[model samples]
Each structure stands twice: as C-alpha cells, then as structure tokens.
Target chain A: MHIRVENLTHIYNQGTPLERTALHEVNLEIEAGERIGLVGPTGSGKSTLVQHLAGLLQPTTGRVLLAGTPIHSKGATARSLRLQVGLAFQYPEDQIFEQSVFREVAFGPRNLGLDETEVKARVHWALEMVGLDPARIGPRMPFTLSGGERRRVALASILAMRPRVLILDEPTAGQDPQGRRALWEKVGQWQQETGMTLIIVSHALEELARLVERVIALRAGRVVADGPTREVLSDARLLRDIGLDVPEPVALLQALRQAGKDVRTDRLLPAEAAAEIASAWGLRRAGA
Target chain B: MKAIPIGMYVPGDSILHRLDPRVKMGVTLVLMTIPFAIHSPWSYLTLSAFIATLVLLAGVPPRTLWRTLRTVFGIAFLMFFLYLFTTPGEPLLAVGPIALTWQGVLAAGGQIYRLCLLVITASLLTFTTSPMQLTHGLEAMLSPLERVRLPVRELAMVLTIALRFVPTLQEEIDKLAKAQRARGADFTGGPLRRARNLVPIFVPIFVSAFRRADELATAMDARGFRSTPHRTRMRRLHLGYRDLLAMLIVLGLVLTLIGLG
Candidate 1:
C-alpha cells in the first residue's frame, strides 16, 4: 500500500501523569514499492511511527493514509488496513506460539482466511524466501530452533501474510556481524522477489545505507531530514547534531578529505569505501 | 486487556506507606478475620470507615482503588442477591412465588459490604508497600515458621520473584497480542474461535516466560545469589511509634466493634 502519514502526533499515557508526546506532527509518504529507512536514536519515536502505520495504535492527532484511505478510522476499515500492513517486531520470537514452524508461519495466511492449499503454499514460499528449508524445519517445534532460526521463522510468519507494505523494526538487533549481514541479505532478496513496499527502522545508519533508497532521520519525535539516503548521509555534522554516529565508512572518507586527500565521503557501503580508499592511497603514492 | 493491577504498588511517602509492612500484614490479617468474628451492620460500617481512612491516608489514587473494586462488583452483587432471596424472614416485597424480606436484604447488604471491606484492605496493603518490602516483611514474619522446618527464606524469594514477573509477563503478553493483531489474528470473533486464536499468542508467551526464567536463574547464579537462611537485607524492618500506633488503632477499632455489635 502507498502509505502517507500527515501531521501525525502520538501521546503515550495521555491525560495521565506520565503523559508524553512520542511523535509530534510527523509527516511522510512512502510510494508503493518504495524502500525507505527510518533512522533515529533510542526514544526517537521510530517504533511508535511504525506501529501507527500498522494501525496497532491510533494517532492522537492527524491520520495515517494507507492506499489513499485514512486508516485511523474506527472498526472494520481500520482493521482491514492493519492486515495489509505487515509489521515484524524486534525479537519477534517472543510472539511465536505455534508448536511447529510450519504451523507458526501458516498462522498469518490462515488468519487471512485463505484455503488450506493456499496457506500451505504461502508458508512454504515464505520459509524458502527466508532461506529456511521448509520440508526440514516444518515439523520441528519452534522453541527447539536456534535463536537465528527462530527469528527467521518469526519473519516468515509475517511474510506469509503477503502484506502490501512490510515494516521491520530493528531486525538485526543483538546479532553478531555475520547474522546481521545474513538477515539483511535475505531481507533484500525477499524484497527484490516480492517488490513489496518496505520501511526498515534501525539506529545503525550504515546498515540501512545500502538497504534503503531513501532515509528519514528523526530526533526528539520530529523528522530532522528526509531525502535520498546518500544526500542525507553526506552531512556528517547534521547527523552528529541529532546524536547519531556518522557511519564508519562515511567518517573514514570525511577524515581523508580533511587531510587534503581527494576522495568522495558519500559512499557508505564497505566495498565501495574500500575501493575508494585504495584508489585514493594509490593516487597519493603517485603524487608523492 | 491492559496490564493486570495485581501488585500495582504506587510509590508514596504517606504514613501508611512508611509503616512497617509487617504491621500492615498484621492489620490485614486481623481485619480479614473480623468478619468471621462479628456479623453486625455497625461492625461492617466501622470496618469500612477504617479501610476508607487507610485508603485516603495512603495517598493512593482513589481511581486506582475504584478500578480494583469495579472488577469484583458483579460478583459482590451476585452474592448479595443470593443471600437476599435465600434467607427466610418477614416478607417485604413479593414477586409471584419469590419474596424479599427486610432482614434478608439487610443481611445481604452486610455480607456484600464486608466482602468489599476485605478487598479494599488487601488492595490497600499492596498499594502502599513495594514488593521488595513486602517480601522482606513476609520473610521476617515467617521466620518463626523456620523452627517448624519450613523453607521460609526460599519461599519468600519465590513469592517476590513471582510478583515481580507479573508485570513483566503482562507487558510481554501485550506485545505478543499486538503482534498477533498486526498479523490479522482477530481475537474479537465468536467465543470458540477467539479461544482458538489465543493459542498463537499464549504459546509464545509461555515459552518466552520459561526462557526468561532460565535466563534469570543463570543471571542470578552468576551474581552469586544463594538462599541462605540468614542474610543481610538492603533495608531492615524496625517497628517505630508510627507502626505501633497504627496497629493499636486498628486493634482498638476491632475490639470496639466486637464489643458494640
């Protein structure tokens, strides 16, 4: 679905002593099949904004428009909006309840009221997309799987729903470097195959750089910058002012440029950074 | 549903909050037993006033107390109706074969009132005392049970941990429920289907809770937590004049109510 958030404001524990605004007049639009990254420090309302997109939370002021319809409406219409927007939470293993992996993944499709054959097909496809061998993992209990496997199962359960838009919150949190890389690779592959609209929320800017086409940086519940990932990431001072670390590769390039070496500072990917640094060193050697 | 309010200890510095939890426990025990000792309207009224006063002094939100009572109101009303219709006395109102009597109505009202008092007093204790203090007080009170070969300290630790996990588990369940909703698991259908849908949310919660329990055990072990019969506490319990005066007042009220009615 084409998602648009307009003047969205969310206040948690409204009217209570703990009342605080989690999001303040935040506005953004995600075109169908558009891939975007939501980057912010902790408590910057990243999770709150995504939850509103899924219609799990009502906006205190303004509305979230899914496919050109206000999803913040009451009752059945809003619920239908929720089904079309799939949200995979961080540590989604905590949401897994089915005894077997197949049954767990089939939950969303089954809830969508699909036929048994269709549900099974969706579950199988989802498992395969996540790089899990469904025939091997289907019968085993979800609790028996390793942590990484369980996380994949959790993702597959949401993927089986085949939502028009997919929002993943910190999918790589608490993982080792290899696990994180593997998760992003699988996610990227799945996105390519399905062409689903994707919004990924993470604090790690570099991880999101190569994953998303556009980046929206938030701080203190307000959108500080929203533009192409490369342009937004090029401004190291703006990122630092919002309490976000400049991604390592970007910082390295900027350091070289400051030392009077000619190099591009906008490359955030490791491979591109390595190539740029190598070429820059070779040029410096020739000049010397 | 929102988070369960089983152990919602609202922090405050009221006299009731500062009183020794052992004394608070003693008062609750004594008040709970009073209904069994005396069955008079005046006694119930005195108990209600005592509870209301403690509730007021504790600085607990009246809304919180009322929220707790609201859940039990239906059951209490049912009890009242049962007593009103079943008891035999001079008939006051007749509807076909069913007759309502003044004595029966009064008896029902007293029963429900006493029930309310019991609930209010218990909630008052939990609202004023933190789980840690309550656990420490329980250990100190049950220390005497150690002479009878009971594992008093271990039992107290278990109770404290269990109380602590109620909120943690509640939050976990809430998140899982939201996740299920996001996946189009409707919990608002027919009773049977709703019950069936609960499996998806609950199974994960059970497994996660167990996993959390295991982690907690490992973490505690790593921290060198041992269940020694005697251990130094972070806060020591001392019965000062305030605790003694509160206990004496509750005791005096119970005695006066017993003698009068």
Candidate 2:
C-alpha cells in the first residue's frame, strides 16, 4: 500500500506535566514496491513516525493515509486499514508468546481468517522464507528456542499476513554476522517477489546503503534529508552534523579529502573509494 | 496514557517539595484524620483554609488540583445523597419515598466536606513527593524493623523496583499490543473474548517479567548487594528546620480541630 504522512505531529502523555513531543509536523510519502531506509539519531522520532504509518498510534494533530484513506478514522475504513501494513517492531523476539512455533507463525494468517490449510501453508512458507525448517521447528514451543531463532519466528508471524507494506524496525539488532546477512538477503528476496513497500530502520549505514536506493534522514523529529542512497550518504558533513556516521567507504573518501589529497568524497562503494584514493595519491607523487 | 493525576508527582520548586517525605506523609495522615472530629462549620472552614493555603504554597496549578477533586466528585455526591435520606431529623421536605431532613443536610454536608479534605490531603503528599522519595522514606521508617530480622532492605528494594517497573511495564504492554494488532488480531470482543485476546499479550509479558527479574537478581548480585549487610544511601533524607516547623504547625492545626467541639 502507498503510505502518506501529512503534517504529522505526536506528543506522548498529552495534558500531563510529563508530556513530551516526539514528532513535529513531519511529512513523507512512501510508494508501494519501493525500498527505503529510515536513518536518524536517537530520540529523533523515527519509531514514532513509523508507528503512525502502521496505524498503531493515533496522531496528536495530523493524519496518516494508506492508499488515500485515513488510517486512524473511527469508521470501517480504519478497521481493515492497519492489517495492510505489517510492522515488525524493535525487539520483536520479546513478542512471541504462543505455545508452539506452528501456532506462533500461524497467528497472523489465522487472525486474517484464513483456512487451516492455508494457515499451515503460509506458516511453512514464512518460516522457510526466514531460513527456518518448518518440520523441525514448527512443533516445538517458541520459548525453548534461542533469542535469534525466536526473533525469526516473530518476523514470520508478520510475514504470514502477506501485507502490502512491510516495515522492519531494527530487525537484525542482535543477530550474528552471518545471520544478519542471511536475514537481509531473505528480506530483499521477499520484496522482489511480492513487490511490497519495504522500509527498514537501522543504524548500520553500510548495510542500509547496500539495500535501499532511497534514504531519508531525520534529526530532532524533522526530515533533514531525503534523496537517493548514494546522494544522501555522500554528504558526509550533513550526516556527521546530525550525529550519524556515514558509510565506511564514504567516510574514507571524506578522510582522504580532509588530508588535502583532493579525492572524490561522493563515492559510496568501497572499490570506488579505493580506486579514487589510489589515483589521487598516484598523481600527488608524480607532481611532487 | 495520561498520568494518573492523584498519585503522580508534579515537579515544582516549592517549600512543600523540599520538606522531608516522612514529615509530609505524617502531616497528611494527621490532616486526613482530623476531619473525623470536625462537625461545626467553623472547624470545616479552618480545615479548608488550611488545605487551600497548602495548595497555594505548593504552587500547584488550580486546574491540576481540580482534576483530583473531579475524580472523587461523583463518589462524594453519592455519599451525600445517601446521607440526605438515611439520617433522621426534623423533615425539611417530603418526597415520594424519602424525606430530606434538617439533620440530614448537616450530616451530608459534613461528610462531603470531610471526604474532600481526605482526598486533597492525601493527594498533596503525593503531588509534592516523588515515588523514589516515598519509597526511601518508607525504608527509613521501617529500618527499625531490621532489628527483628524483618528483611527491611529487601522489602524496600522490592517496592522500589515495583514502582520503577510500573512505567516500563506500561511501555512493554503497549509495544506487545501494537505488535499483535499489526498481525490482524482484533481486540474488540465480548468479556470472555476480550480476555482471550489479552492472553496473547499478557502471557508474554509475564514471561518477560520473570526473565527480567532473574536478570535483575543476577545484576544485583554482581554489584555486591549480597556482600554487605549494611546499606548506604546516595542522598540521605534529613529532617531540617522546615520539617520541624511543618510538624509544629500541623500539630497546632490538629489540636485546633479537636478543640472545636
């Protein structure tokens, strides 16, 4: 589904002495089948904004529309609206509570009123999609698994719904190195197959740059930068000013330029940055 | 969710806020009880004036105080009307089933006045004192029980952790509920169905809470909590001149209230 956030502002615990504003007049449009990365410093309202888009939170002032219909409305449109956008929250592993992995992964499809056969099929597919073997893992209690495995189970629960939009909030936070890469690869493949809107929120800029073409940077609850991945990541100063690190390759290019090497800083790929740095130093030695 | 107004602390820099929590709590107890002795209008006026003065000195916004009062207004009215018909006296007016009596008017008026004073008095203590201060004060008050092997320190720590977890647990429940709702789990249903819906949220919360408790115990042990029997405070509570003055003033008011008869 196409998501639109218009003039959105959110305040937590409104009308109390402890009340705080988390988001302020924020706005963005997300097209279906688009891959986007949401990057921000801590307390920048990134999670709050995505929750509004998913219809988990009602806006304090403005509105969020899914496919041109308001998602927080009191009528029937909102009743089915939230189901279209699947939100895998931060620390999704903590959300698993079902008795068996089969029931756990089947939670979403069952809630969607699918038949038992369809639920079983979807659960099997989603578990395999997240790299879990359905036969070995499906019959066991969810609490008996490791944290990483349980997190995948929680993710499969959301995937069983087959939502048009999938939002992963720090989905690979505590994963091992290979586990992270494997999970991201699966997400990429799933989006390619389904052509769903995919938004990933993470602090790992290098992984984000590899996955998403569009990058939106937020700081202090406002959208400070929105552009293609290379363009946004290339602005090393802008990212650093907002207390976020640039991709490692982009950082290296900027460091070379800072040392008066006259190297290109707009490069995001590691091979390109290495080639640019070698040529700059090669020319410097010849001129010297 | 909005903060539960009556028990929530409103941060302020007032004389009442600086007073020791024990003294404030004691004064609240006294004020809350003195209403039982109040029957004459003069005594009620004195108590109302005293509470209003306390409210002014605390610099709490009138609107915030009104919220505390508004919550109990319905209960106060119910008690007032119940007293209006039940208490016997000369009949002022006769309705179909009940008679409004002159003595009933006095009795109900006094009951409502007393109930309001009790609520305001209790709310004032919490409004000026944080949960941490309250727990610490309770610990200090109960330290004497340690001589009898009552495990007072652990008791206080339990209370402190429970108080701290109130908000953390709230956030956790909110996150879990939202995650479930995202999976097309509708929360709307009849009573049994609603409870059944909550099972998905509450069961995980219970497991998480237990896991957190285990981790907390391990963490506390790692920090040398079990190595020493004696405990120390980062900031010790002291009874200063203000606490003594507040005690004397409330004591005088208590005497004044009792002597009104």
Candidate 3:
C-alpha cells in the first residue's frame, strides 16, 4: 500500500510539564515499491513520523492515509493496519518472549487470527527470508542467541506478518560490519522480489545510501529535505546543518571536487564513487 | 510514564545526606519503635515534635512531605474514623447517631499521629539515603543472617536492580503505549475494558522486563559477580563522633517519650 502522511503533528504529554512536540506539520508520501531512507539525529522525530505510517500513532493535528484511506478515521482498527505495515522497533529483541523462536515469529500472524497452517508457513518463510534455518533455529531459546542472530530473528518475527510496507528502525544497529552488510543485502533482495515499500530509519548515512532510492531528512520534528537519494545526500551543507554526517565517500568526493578534481560528489556510496572514478580514469587512458 | 522518582535520593552536601546510612537506618529503627509505645496524647505530641524537627533538619520541602503523605492518607483517614466511633469514655459531645468523647478524640489523634510519623520517618530515610547506601546498610544489618544461608547479598542485589530499572521500565511502557496508540489501540476504554486492553501492553512490558533481567544477569556474570563469602567495601561504615552524638540524642528522645507515656 502507498503510505500517505498529510500535515502530521504529534505532541507527547500534551498538557503536562514534560510535554514535547515530537512531530511537526509533516507531509510526505511513499509510493508503492519505493525504498525510502529516513535519516536524523537522536530525538529528530524520524521514529515518530514513521510510526504514523503504520497508524501506530495518531497525529494530534493532521492525518495519515494508507492506500488513500484515513487510518485515523472512526472505526479504523489498528489490527488491520498493523497487518499492512510491519514495524520492526529498535532493539526488537526485547519484544521476543515466547518459549522458542518459532512461537515468537508466529506471534503477529497468530494475533491476526490466521489459520495454524498459514501461521506455520509464514513463520517458516520469514525465518528463511532472514537466512535462518527454521529447523535449526526455530526451537532454540531466542534469549540465548548471539546479538546478530537475535536481531535477525526479531526481524523475522515482523516479516512473518507479510506487511506490504516494511518499516525498520535502525535494523543494522549494534551489528558487526559483516552482519550489517548481510542483513542489508537480504532486505534489499526481499524488497526487490516482493516490491514491498521499504522505509529504513538509520543514523548511518553510508548504510542507508546502499539500500534506499530516496532520502527524507528530519531535524527537530520537521522535514528538512525530501528528494532523490543523490540530490538529498549531495547537499553536504544541509546534511551537516541537520547534524547528519555525510557518508565518507560522499564527503571525500565533495572535498576532491572542491580541490578542482573531476569527481562526482553525487555518488554517496563507496562503491558508486569507486566505480565512477575507475570509469573516469578509463576514459583518460583511452584519450592518452 | 515519566519516572516517578520514588525512593530516589538526591545526592547533596547537606548534613543529613552526609550521615552514614547505617546511622540513619539505626535512628529510623529506633523512631519506628517509639510510635508503637505511644499510648497518650502527650507522648504522641512529643513524637510529632521529634518528626517535625527531623523533617526540618533534613531540609525536605513541604511538597515532598505532601506527596509522601498522599499515598497513606486513605489509611490514615480510615483509622481516624474507626477510633472516633469505637473508643469508649465520658462523652464530650453528641451529634445525630455519633458521639464524641475525650477518650475517642485521644485514640483518633494517637492513631493519626502514629501513622503520620511512620510514613514521615520512612520517607526521610528514603529521601536522604541513596538506594545503593540503603542496600549496603541492609546487607550490613543482615550480615548475621548470612550464617543461616539467607542470601543477604543476593537479596540486596535484587533490590538494587529493581530500583534501577523502575525508571527504565516506566519509559518502556510509555514508548510502547505510544507505539500501540499509533497503531490504533484504544486505551481509554472503561475501567474493566481498559484493564483488559492492558494485555497487549503488559505482554510487551513483561517480555522486555524479562529480557532486561536476562541481559543484566549475563552482564553481572561477565563481571564475575559470584556468591562469595568475602568482599571489600569501597566505603566502610564507621561510627564517627557526630553519628554517636546523633544516636545518643535519638535514644534520649525515645526515653523521654517513654517516660511521658
């Protein structure tokens, strides 16, 4: 489903002394099959804004429409919206509680009142999608697993619901380099195969550059920038203003460009920069 | 739910804050016992005066006292009403279906006074002494019971962990509630329905709490927290001249109250 947010605003503890405005009048749209990256510093309201996409939070002032229907409209049930938008919370491992991994992953589907056979199939498929062998890992204690393994299992628990729009909040947080790369590849492939709308929130600019086609930058509960990945990320001044560090390669390319080198600062990822540099040198060699 | 800050000790350089927690604990124990011995109006007045003096010395604001008193106000009110009706003596006044007597007034006053003093003293200890120091004092006080394998250290450790995580779990609950509400879960239903609605929340909370407990256990194990008979203290409790003087003053007050009774 295409997620539509219109002038969304949310304030926590509305009348109390600790009241905080977590989201401003934000407007954005996620087209079907588009991979969107959400980048912001801590307390920038990226999480609050995305939580609205799944109808997990009601906008205090505006509205969120999923598939052109107002999710906060009267009679709209969270259970139905939850099925359409799967949210993998930060530190999702804390949400795992069942005796075994199988039961934990099966929780969402079961809550939806799916048939036993269907629940089992989704559980098996989700475990496999995250690259965990269901037979080997299904019965193991989730609490005893390694951190990376537990994170994948947590993601599997959400994936089992087969949400059309997958929202992962820092999916690669606390993972080693290898684990981070592997999980991104798996998620990217899954999005491509299923054409699911993917929204990933992360502080790691380099990691987000690898998976998303578009980037939405948030600062102080407002959207500072929302556009194509190359366009948003190439604006180093804006990124820095919002407290986000540019990806190393992007920063390096921008520096080289400032030094009058023929380098494309638009290339945000390391691989993209490397490929562009090699092609440029290849052209020079041909001319020579 | 923001952390309620119960049992939180704000570290300061004030005299009460600087006192050894063992000394505070001992004084608190003595004060708690004196209330039980109060049987007359004069003795209750003496106990109230002692509490008021301590409250002033501790420098706790009136707001803190009110917040602590609010928790036990219902019980205090109940005891007041019970004693007013039940105590027998020469009638002082009578209203429709209610008789007021000197004995009844004294009984009600005494009960209310005792309840107020108990709560105030407990609050003073908790407010002035950090949970870490309180737990240490408890471990020291219960050291003799260790011979009977009572697990004093383990119990203290558990208390410390619980105190540390109350704020964490409260923050988690707030986050989860916001998350669920964003998903359209209704929490504003009527009492019974609202109670039932807490299942989804309670499930996640209990899950997370257990997860935290497991992580804490692993961290503690990695730090070599084993059941050992010997451990050195970073700050040992010693009875300084000031503590001795404070203890003697408390003992004298207790004696005076008993003599008045």
Candidate 4:
C-alpha cells in the first residue's frame, strides 16, 4: 500500500519535565512495491517515523494516509492497519516466548484467526523463505538457537502474517558478515516474489545501497534527503554532514572524478562501480 | 522507548545535592518523626514552614514538586475523605447524607498533612540524592546485618542492578508494545477483550525481561563481578559539617514539636 505522511509531528511525554519532540513536521510519500531505505544516526527519529507507518504511533499534529485512508481518523483502527503493514522491530528475537520455533512462527497467524491447516502452511512457508528447514528447526526451543538463527525465526514470525507492507528496523544487526548477506538476500527475494512494499531502516549505507532503489536520509527528526540510492549515496558532502559514511565505492568514485578521471560517481555498489570502471578503461576480462 | 526514570536523579551542584546521602537519610528519618509529635495546628504549621523552607533552599523546581504530589494525590484524598466521614465526633456541618465533625476535620486534616509531608520529604531525598549515593548509604546502614548472614552486599548489588535496568525494561516494553501493535494486536477493545489482548504484550515483556536478566548476568560475569565480602568502592562517601548541621537542625525541630505536643 502507498503510505503518505504529511507534516507529522510527535512529542513524547507531553507536559512532563522530560518532554521531547521526537519528530518535527516530517513529510514523505512511499509508493507501493517500492523498496525504500531509511538511513539515520542514532536518535535521529528514524524508528519513530517508521512506527507511524503501521499506526503504532499516533501523530501529535499532522496525519498519515495509508492507501488514501487517514490512519489516525476516528473510524481508523490500528489493528486493521497493522494487518496491511508488518513491522519487525530491532533485535526482535528478544520477543520470542513460545516453546518451539513452529509455535513462535505460528503466533501471528493464530492471532489473525487463521485455520489450523493454513497456519501450519504459513509457518512452513515462512521458515522456508528464511532458508531454515522447518523439519529441522520447528521443534527446537527458540531460546536454544544461536543469535543469527533466532533473528531469522523472528523474521519468519512476522512473515507468517503476510503483510502487504513490510518494515524492518536493522534486520541484519549483530549478525556475522555471511549471515547478514544471507538475510538480505532472503529479504530481496521475498520482496520480489510477493511484490510487497519494503522499508528497511539501518546505518549500513552499503548494504542498503545494494537492495533499495531509493534512500531517505533523516537528521534530527527531519528528512534531509530523499531520492534514488545512487543519487543520495553520491552526495558525499550531504552524507558526511549528517554523520553517515558514504559507501566506499561511491566515495572512491567521487575521489577519482575529482582527480580528473572520467569516472561516473553515481554507481554506489562495488559491482556496479567495477562494471562502470571496466567500460571506462576499455578493459576486457578473460571470462568475458 | 524512553529510559526508565528510576535513578534519573538529576545532576546538580546545589547544597542539597552535595550533602552526604547518609546525612540526608538521617535527616529524613528525623523529619519523619515530627509528624508523629504534631498534635495541634500550630505544630503542623511549624513543620510545614520548615519543610517549605528546606524545599526552597534546595532550589528544586516547583513543577517537580507538583509532579511528585500528583502521583499520590488520589490516595491522599481517599484517606482524608475516609477519615472525615468515619471518625466519631460532635457534628460541625451537614451536607445531604454526609456529616462533617470537629474531631473528624482534625483527624482528616492531620492524616492528609502527614501523608503529604511523607511523600514530599521522600521525593526531596530522591531528588537530591543519586542512586549510587543512595545505594552506598543503604549499604553503610545495613552493614551490621552482615553478622546475621543477610547477604547485605549481594542485596545492595541486586538493588543497584534493578535500579539501573528500570529504564531499559521500560524502553523494551514500549518497543514490544509497538511491535505487537504493528501485527494486528489491538489493546483497546472491551474489558474482556482488552484483558485477552494483554496476552501478547505481557508475553513479550516477560520473555524480554528474562532475556535481559540473563544477558546482564553474563555481562557481570564477564566483567569479573563476584560476591566478595570485602570490596573497595570507586567513590567513597563522607559526612562533613553540612551533614552535622542539618542533623542538629532536624533533631531540634523534632524535639520542639514533641515538647509542644
């Protein structure tokens, strides 16, 4: 579903001594089937903004429209909006409470009042999507799994809900390099297969550069940049000013261009940059 | 998620903030006795003036005091109303089914005054003292309990950890609630439905709390924390002239209130 936030503002602990304004008149439009990356430093209100997509947080002033429906309206129900938008929180493995992985993955389907057969099918399908063999992992206690395994189980739990819009906050955090790559690959495949709108919040610009077509940069609760991934990553000054490290390849491409080389700086990922460099230098690989 | 406000002792360089926590504890104890000694309105007024002067000298914001008062306002009102109606005395005023008496007013007013003084004094102590200082003071006060094998050190350690994790747990709960709400879990249904809805929230909260406790235990073990009887502190607390003067003033106040009563 298309999500639009207009002049959204959120003030926490209003009228208290610890009152804080987390989001300030933020405006953004997300189209359906679009892969968007939300990039920001800690405490930049990225989490606060994304929580509004699923109606988990009510806007203090403005409004959020999901599929042309204002989610904060009098008739709006967060429960119905939630079915259309799934949010997997940071370190979601900590939320696991069931005895086994199967039951844990089935929790969402059960909550949705699905039949037994359909719930089982969803659990199995979700586990397979995350590259975990249901037969091998289903009966295992969730608490006994390794960190990466638990993370995948957490993702599978949300996937069982089959939301049209998926929001993941740092889905690959605290994972080994191999695990991170595998998780992202699965996420990419899921998005493609289901054609769901995906929003991933992370500090890893390089990883986001590989998956999302567009990036939204936030600094102190306000949108600083919103555009194509390549365009956003190539803007070195803007990225550095917001405390985000531009992707290595993008930075290198910028440096090469500044040194009077005829190199394109818009390529963000390493593979894309390598291809551009080969064509620029007119070099032919042995395999090609 | 907002950090738990426990141990959120605001950092300040005021005289009250700098006072030794042990002295503060002693003075709080002494001040608590004045309410017991108060019989007439004059004694209560004297105690109220003393407390107000101390609060003013501490330089705490009036907003902070009101916030603390608001927390117990309901209970204070309930106690006052209960005593006003239930106490036996000569009737002073009658309104519909309710009858107010002279003795009832005195009793209710005294109870309310005592309740307010207790809450405000405790809040003042917490406002001026950091958790670390409070824990240190507790340990010192309970040191003699070590002879009875009460695990005083371990208890203090547990308290310190619990205080430290209050904000973390609150943040976790907030995050879990949002996460659940994002998955079609409604917590605003009818009474029965709402109670049922809490299943998802409480399950996650309990799971995370246990997980956090385990992680904290591991972290403490990794940091070489052990149950040792003799351990050195990074910061030691000492009582100075300010503590002595404060203690003497509190003692004098208590004595005068008792003598008048």
lDDT (0 to 1) per candidate: 0.86, 0.87, 0.82, 0.85
Clashes of 2: 0
Q: Which candidate has the top score in DockQ?
A: 2
TM-score of every model versus the real structure = 0.92, 0.92, 0.72, 0.90
lDDT, candidate 4, A88-190, per-residue tens: 9888887777889999899888878899999999999999999999999999999899999999999999999998899999998899999999999999999
Task: List, for all models, the DockQ compared with the true complex.
Answer: 0.55, 0.69, 0.15, 0.48
DockQ of 2: 0.69
Instruction: By lDDT, rank the candidates, best first.
Output: 2, 1, 4, 3
* A234 Cα displacement, candidate 2 (Å): 1.5
> Which ranges in model 3 have alpha carbons more than 4 Å from their true place?
A1-34, A42-84, A100-102, A114-150, A162-165, A174-179, A189-197, A218-226, A237-245, A279-288, B10-14, B42-46, B49-67, B70-113, B139-260
Window of ten residues with lowest summed lDDT in model 3 chain B: B1-10
lDDT of 4: 0.85
DockQ pick, better of 1 and 3: 1
Q: Kindly report which residue pairs in candidate 3 clash with one another.
A: A55-B182, A55-B183, A56-B182, A56-B183, A57-B182
The list of candidate 4 runs beyond 4 A from truth reads: A13-20, A74-78, A115-118, A134-136, B1-8, B91-101, B147-150, B189-199, B202-215, B218-229
- Which 10 consecutive positions of candidate 4 chain A have the poorest summed lDDT? A73-82
Q: Which 10-residue window in model 3 chain A sums to the lowest lDDT?
A: A279-288
Q: lDDT per residue, candidate 1, A146-196, as tens digits?
A: 988999999999999998899999998887889899999888887898899
RMSD of each: 2.9, 3.5, 5.8, 3.1
| Tens-digit lDDT string for candidate 3 (A119-232) | 999999999999999999999988779989999988888888888999999988888999989998999988987889999998877777778989999999999999998899
